[model samples]
Target: MSSSRYLTNQFLIAMPGLEDPNFFHSVTYICEHNDNGALGLVINRPLEMQLGEIFQHINIEHADPDIRQIQVHLGGPVQQDRGFVLHEPLGDWEATLKVTDRIGVTSSIDILQAIAINEGPERTLVALGYAGWGAGQLEQEMADNAWLSGPADPEILFRTPDAERWRAAAASLGIDLDLLSGEAGHA
Candidate 1:
């Protein structure tokens, strides 16, 4: 696969044919992609718990009701217990993977601490776990039409409602997923 084909900072909109329980109808933000594999966070699946629950679990006291009510997303099926903070303005963080100059995903607790007190990045999407693919695995999925790939849009990531992200992401590519068949074609 050509290096130019790497999907970092892109959106992987699951194809209608993808039947996996974890990814069906999901729109994943590709954070890192290279010869090693791909790492992404599913943006659409919000868990029942809110940010307040996470603060309580981590023993961080926060007084802002707006911050506490933020919905936490289920990023993917992998490492479901770990927290990942995807934020904009890419500030200095302990363990952040800079996907682009504008966005970063931080796993360190310090970012969360700052978040609890409203001193963190201006826009953040807090999630648990992440989507990962081994070397060549994602390429194969692409060839098999498992997803529609396109440049990542911050509006969809930071502002779009969880329930609409799937369609919104596909729409970004001029695709109406509702019209697509749940069957793959071999050209």
Candidate 2:
């Protein structure tokens, strides 16, 4: 680990009129930030699939009543078939990656099973994909005004309704989505 962490657990709010079909109006939760690059989940994009559907596909018994009704989110463009669970801070799982003091991400089946049984972290968001960038790619995009960065709010990550997450995330940075423009250039 680097002595200085970049922006782990921050929110990467998409600028208005962004042309990227995958990220327009997106609110991403940074899971890892280092020299290797960054990884995040797009919190506002919802797919047609549900959590129960995913569990069944993986042969994991969905015995817990609570998770059956949960909606699965489109985390990003990478590994669309994989599962990533962003949850309230609980005891560390074998494969858990601590994004912040308050949040943890678990990508292993054991965590999924624990979640299926209601033995997992109390607050959680299930995603089926993730956003990633090569070295310096994210920084270049940020420099081009492709994204706005802000502190991540746990409430926004786990409790805010999907439709509202984008605006909510932008609002956290004092940015009004309606006032933003996509064109990027030197002033």
Largest TM-score belongs to which candidate? 1
Cα RMSD, each candidate = 1.6, 2.3
Mark the regions of model 2 whose C-alpha exceeds 4 Å error after superposition: 1-5, 184-187
TM per candidate comes to: 0.96, 0.92
lDDT of 1 by residue, 1-187 (tens): 5657899999999988899999999999999999999999999999999999999998999999999999999999999999999999999999999999999999999998998899999999999999999999999999888888999999999999999999999898888888888774421
Error of 2 at 51 (Å): 1.2
Candidate 2 Cα deviation (angstroms), residue 66 = 3.1
Residue-by-residue lDDT tens digits, candidate 2, 1-187 = 6625376889988888676988988999989988889999999898887788888888988776668778899999999988899999756787888887778888988888887887888898999889998888888888888888878998899899999999998888777788767873321
Q: Give lDDT per model, in order.
A: 0.94, 0.85
TM-score of candidate 1 on Cα atoms, chains taken together: 0.96
